[model samples]
Target chain A: MNTPFSPERAAELGDAERRGSAAQLAATSGLPDTSSEAWRYSPVSDLNLDELRVVTGAPPAPPDAPQYVTEAIDSLQAAATVSVIDGFVVAVELADGWVAKGLSVESAAVKLAEPEEGPNLFDHLHAAFAPDGLVIKVPAEVEITDPIVIRSHLSEGAAGFTALKVHASAGSRVTVFEYQSSESGGLVVPMTQFHVEQAAKVNHVVIQDLATDSWQVGRVTSRVEEHATLSSAMIAFGGKYARIRTDSDLAGRGATGELVGAYFCDGDQIIDYRTFQQHIAPDTLSDLLFKGTVDDESGSVYTGMIHIHPDGAGSNAFQTNRNIKLGDEAWAWSVPNLEIENNEVRCSHASTVSPVDPDQRFYLHSRGVPPAVADRLIVAGFFEEALRRVSIPAAAQIARTLIAEKLDVRLEQP
Target chain B: MSELIVDQLAVKVGGSQILSGVSLTVPGGEVHAVMGPNGAGKSTLSNAIMGRSGYEVTGGTITMDGQDMLALDTFERAQAGLFYVMQAPTEVPGVSMFDMLTASLSAQGTASTDLAATLSAEAAAIGFDVALLERSLNVDLSGGEKKRSETIQMSVLAPKVAIIDELDSGLDVDGLRTVAQRVEKLTNDGLGVLVITHFPRLLHELNADRVHVLAQGKIVTSGGPELAIELEQTGYGAYVEEETPEPKSGGLDDLFSM
Candidate 1:
């Protein structure tokens, strides 16, 4: 058993009902090990559960707003901004127009009462520790023109857990930008669930820029109904061990899902990603592209699988993952898998791990670009393909700036 | 003298001699054409001068404005006022043509903003489309467009010495004429040029000051503009002899022994 949950501690946290269910589940199942397929190529064995303490009670007041958060809000012109500090929702602002249009934010208990698909130790741990969560819901057929921004910051030595559920009604449209950032050592587990109804369109982007000593394990699970479209882009550039697992389900015919991610890590950091694209209905389509770069002693791991069930005949899927290793010590592992149960389906997967192209470097050098500057340009251009697919101008710009800053540091290195 | 000089240059590629004891010179303000047969090592010389890897210069003294170029890296050579138009320009997916041109110009201490205006004006003057400037470097461009884009890059950098290898290979009639006009314009503006081509039309259009015929890794002939016309009419067959008959499978020793 993990750790016995004290009922008195749950009462002190003021969420005994939710914590009870999480305790029951945690008592039954333990953390995943390297032998588990989902945890392969990850640093799961290195995680120390004893060092983590459950954060409870009222969330401390947030510190002064950081520059990046302010800049992202201004650039995106967000309709509603929600701030979470130390595992609790500190503040939320819903624009007057959005409020009139039936957009609402509410505090709720963790809803993972029973084990559903893709349940893990982190989910139960979050439910047991997190006191409250923020839910953003859009009404049927309504469209929110401006994005909703959720910004999270974890203080030093604080192990924070937070949950977010986004529900878009049939024929509705919404875009959300989640920015996770910190400057000190900590642990943060954030789980986000999306329910995209029939004919609805949703765009979600997660940008992670944490401190070098921080660790994050994030999970994003979404279900798409008939004719609905789901697009997600993950841009990560921080953390000692930052990982995101995305599970996208196309449950109805004609549903479409697109996933793209770009990440860069330096120092001794590690960025890991595992994604599942499940096509359960006929004629559904899914496409994924992930590109990343690692410099110094940093490394990255990407493993994704596209599964087309028997009912998924006439479906189409494509997955591509490309990585660049900048230094001799830098490493990358990319594995793309495809599973098809029907003959009429069309699926393709490609992966590559290499250093920067020498021919490209020579081409730039012949044109008077110095070696270091040439590398910076090539790395920036490497991410441009996915950056252009972001569809959100402000989010794309934010990603571009972060990547450029990282390259700048690389150039300044001895 | 401020001239691009190649003195007794010998180059090897992968342990095979490609350019042997080749010597030539193109002084400032003159256009020189190196006309040769298909295997005449014209491209090898350009690669050797630009310090492309795998093209080893065993013996050579390549100098521009009295500065030794063989010792410099490719980018350093460019900084020393040497530019090359490659036969097959690489496609860089994310870097735009404008970005490359600006970066090159900035290396020469010119502000990118100021150079952008000049580049736009030059593009207009040369009849090149300005929309291509926004595209990734050499990506998804037509053959002729890639050549013209290289020319545009040349106009932006304004290097003192430029080596253009087979600039007319992928060009149409109009493209050839436009490129010839640009070459003449740049030459008249006092930029020395060395043109390597199989056809004489571009050299004739540029009013080349000299023409050198390279055969078997060496320059066997040099002349004025009339040589280009002569080579165009006679082809390279007259200068190159057929391979000598095989050794007769050691017939002389067999006959003597018998």
Candidate 2:
């Protein structure tokens, strides 16, 4: 199979070998099929990667910058922006403070070392081109209020890879907002790894808005230290095939983790998400809630697990996934699992998959709210729990609008 | 000026007729007590009046304030001053009482009034914590607490007509007195009150203007408070005594009547 070279991997090699190596990685990595757990809901075999080439289209001209990002990024004066053009990181915007601390940003193709078992898929992503990869490390006690923005723009016929690594020191508060936007015919693969030291806090908000013909596969992992707090929120809309896999570990005593995901699917779109909240130490806590609604033949899948190890005594954890079936054909599959070996731990998991209640519809319709408006109200109420918990105000507002638009329903501002 | 008039109402549930030829009326600013033994179509009549989704009203006209109450949905009926405090309130897991009240109030198209402050003052008068106002709506609530919470909702929403079913069944003496006082306030404010109860204690406190005895889905008798005292003494035997001739097959039927 013939494939294109990744821009990131080419940076580590002479121009000639970089394309060869990237082509090899792309050729060896097949499109995901039904056999993989992550690809269960979205069948990618039909994507036909063999014929797709690396996108070479120019990035879309920046629109009026979003006010939310402008304010949130400005607050993090010490952070930098790693901008991606057609899945390739074309430029890195670094806060002068970070460049002074020996921070470096470049594209490199990392290879997976041979292990006892076969190489993991994520390592393959690392081994391929990382044209938009950024390596970040902060000193101890360097608190930053502003957020670092990693913005990705996918132009026409663009396909690329982007990866990020954020390492935070003890007692530091760092916020990162990753924006994935595309209006092109291509695929964007993004994988991020976060490291939080003891007594540190890291907040992440991932916003995905790709073109209707685009595909996005995002994977994020957070390794949390003792007494560390990690809050993550993923907001996604408008992708032909979008799936996000998030894994976090509360490895230290008194560590806390918060995971929230809100998505809207419309126009035969498919969005699937999987999250893992692991409690590995005593006195640790984790909360997970992923809520979404599907309309217009759209579908969503949410599978979450909270694993409490035997050593995780006094661990308190909960996982909830709820979805509203808007379209007669729209579907959602939610599987919540709890594995607990400790006797003193408290854990519960619940999942509900049902159409809007007839009674609730009648209740709203009786109030002069038209049937369509009534349905929107119920769907909005369905996701209100997650929307209220979205830490970013602008993100929350956009989520509300996206939900309304996906349903093709309009709401008078309350 | 306001009245809930049900004319010859017939209702069916699960393919069985539970209420037939049932006709009753509750006028404005009055407390009407409907007393019947279990399975006598008491709750079915109330549910039919409020236009519950499943109950099939085979034949009836329910008019409130000379308007077609039967045409309204449950919440619309409520918005038009009709309230149904269920014998067993539905459990809303994530909805808080405070939020439900505000939403309901807004749905009723009420504007610019402080329901929370009014409810707080009422709760203080009833010796309940203002904090109880923060609890989830009927979630993790005790039977008595659920009843009290419904009572608070009625007080705060201030519907035009309140239909309270078995409000005293599960309450302690103190809780019962508190609800009775709330009902009195509603009636004082000119809202029609229809309280359904099998016992005389609730009516004794309510001082219902009309006492209707329902037997076999019909109002067999209607009178003042004395009617309750007479039914209590005669054990519904007087009505049967004058009606039943030859008591050979009067086993379950007689027990049900009593």
| Best of the candidates, lDDT | 1
Candidate 2: docking tier: incorrect
C-alpha lDDT of residue B30 in model 1: 94
In the range A1-414, model 2's lDDT, one tens digit per residue, is 344445443444344364545446655766655786656766566565544455433345544335655554455453667676655566767767755654444544432223222444334443454453566666677776656677777665555666677777898877777777775667777777788999998888887878777877767778789999888888888688887777888899989999888888877788889888789999998988888777768889898878898899999998888887767888888988888888899887888878877766554433333445556656766776787777666566666666666665434323
Q: Candidate 2: where is the Cα deviation over 4 Å?
A: A1-19, A48-61, A65-127, A149-152, A211-213, A249-257, A277-286, A305-317, A338-347, A357-378, A387-398, A404-414, B91-158, B168-182, B229-258
Task: Count clashing residue pairs in model 2.
Answer: 11
Alpha carbon lDDT of residue A43, candidate 1?
77
lDDT of 1 by residue, B1-258 (tens): 258999999999999999999999998789899887766788898889889899999997999988899989999998787888877788998999777767776776774667667767777766677887787888888778888888888887878889998887667778878887887888888889998876677686778899999877898999999999987666777556567222321134322432
Index of the highest-TM-score prediction: 1
* Pairs that clash in candidate 1: none
Provide the TM-score for each candidate, comma-separated: 0.93, 0.79
